[model samples]
Target: MMWKIQLFKLNFDHRERDAVLETVDSGWLTMGERILGFEAAFGDYLGHGARCTAVSNGTAALHMALLALDVGQGDEVIIPALTFVADANAVRMVGARPVLADCASRSDWNVSAESIARKITPRTKAVIVVHYAGFPCDMPAIAALCRERGLKLVEDVAHAPGASIAGQMCGTFGDVGCFSFFSNKNLSIGEGGMVVACDGNLSQRLRYLRSHGMTTLTLDRHKGRAATYDVAEPGLNYRMDEIRAAIGLVQLDKLPAGNLRRKELTERYRRNLAGSPLQMPFDNLSADVVSAYHILPVLLPQACDRMGVIEMLKTAGVQSSIHYLPFSGFTAYREYFTAQDAPLAEEICSRELTMPLYPTMSDREVDLVTGALLGAVA
Candidate 1:
């Protein structure tokens, strides 16, 4: 059903359209100069002299990072059970088992270092930490734990592109950081992603693995730089097209301001929902960390009727959603894992509800949502 307020919406304008048109007018739609420009600009935005490789999507970026880190069969990668399914699917795609970890309480919905430590074993090769709902995980402790265990770190920064910990960007703290530009993301480009790493060799591997392991790109041949190319190794055709790259460039420029707006709106949610039954995350977070504000998730009371609240909100012309269920709760994953261990994650999943929090939403809309929520939970 269509609600008065959608959970998320694209905020594109003439600039995005113009960028796509320019790419079309250039008559080169495949991976080429535009993609290179997007990668360079993304790297600059991420700071810390990051090296980036634009991929087809966030899933491809995760797969490539795993491949670059040499994670394969018989290896186990620890990840939060509270994230989108793509993270776990990527681990399985690489022939690795995803050792799901429980998130902390609602105040901190991200997986903690203690949960990660509990999941580690002799076969554990890496840890894929997801910055859930744009909030940066405890990078200092998580990074230190990774170092102590000699494990590769892959950060799934799909929700927290602009988020930082201690002034350093979220993606910069890990061995390889992945991002998504899906239509719902803060920096949406319909379908696109990027991977970043400080190590030049790892960056090179990511670049090579994105395009069938080609020794030279088609752009090189088009620009008369190379007449022929050689294949280096087996790789997937996970290259972003020039059209998406053009859109990405425009979206990148708007990200910082968009994130700021999201932060402002988040404050509004907190203020409006004050004394309400819903529990908000990141309320007592550290000063050094800043969230990307991609989502606004709240936990309903355990005894509250979740589906009844959703229906009531719908009747009141508001749209609400669930962030996710623990991966082990799904039938596909249930056979492989158990939910008994992830008590907090499972509990939070049952009560978590995502409300509308986009850049273009208005104060009246926020008031409507909060009013409807209060009435629903009453």
Candidate 2:
């Protein structure tokens, strides 16, 4: 059988179209009812009574969160070297220095709390923790550390939309939890994001910042009872469109079912790959940590070349990818941290390979991928 599986694919059906059409027929296209609805629903999902502010993308959400916290020049933000470059780039955008920290081997792909402690300086204003590949980081420990040091905590929850640690939702654990609803995320809106804030004051500030620092959003000003507005502060155009928000609302409804399917598929992948040399992601230390299984990443033994394995898998029609290259390894970050400082990140990057795992993937597809992986390693 000829297989044409992809690394990731968006799951869209008539539900998304109906939602979008409803917004279009209403003749309101910008941020409006759909956006507010999604924000409220997302807050309810997180269980923290947090205020959610929708934005254009995850990067914008991160940027706005940092700005809301007054993080800027002369400030330092600690982040895991294992995360995507966007995590660090957001810090740089705010004129704050991104202090890269190493991750722990035993804890999967999360930055070590000890490593974070080592890098903290008096200039450290915040710590950004990434829940890599849907695996929840040690948030309680990291949160405690931040509280002890008087540092704000920002969560890069791009890959962990439905994840929780110790019964606490991923986004609620931190002061500001940033999420991406990109096409590939667990719950997607094509190109949208949301920031959940613990503080009402901070949430209000973010609401203004996402709408070009306006005292009120376009919906607020034009829809009802508003005629004039003022620019409270300089902000960016990061508002989420009604169309995307409409799709997101539908996607949100299906998230629970989709996540359950992902979990089942993940268990099957683990069972099929058992007794093989490939290293699977570790189970959460606590029962409360429920992952949505965004990607099924396996660590190949050092004896096998990572890129070589990826190429071989491609030849076999099994799509594969690296979850991320260490942020510190990128040329842009080289100016800040040396390559030698992130040894764990380097090792993980060299061995990491993300295999296909989506709700649409079939049993045959999973078998083909595992078979190809086994052959490549052997």
Query: For candidate 1, what is the lDDT?
Result: 0.91
Best by lDDT: 1
- Model 2 regions lying over 4 Å from their true place: 1-3
* Model 1 agreement with the true structure over 166-230: per-residue lDDT tens digits: 88998999999999999999999999999999999999889889999999988899899999998
* Candidate 1: count of backbone clashes, pairs at least 3 residues apart or interchain: 0
CA lDDT, every prediction?
A: 0.91, 0.87
TM-score of 2: 0.96
Best by TM-score: 1
**How many collisions per candidate?**
0, 0
lDDT per residue as tens, model 2, 16-56: 98988898899999988889899999889888777899999
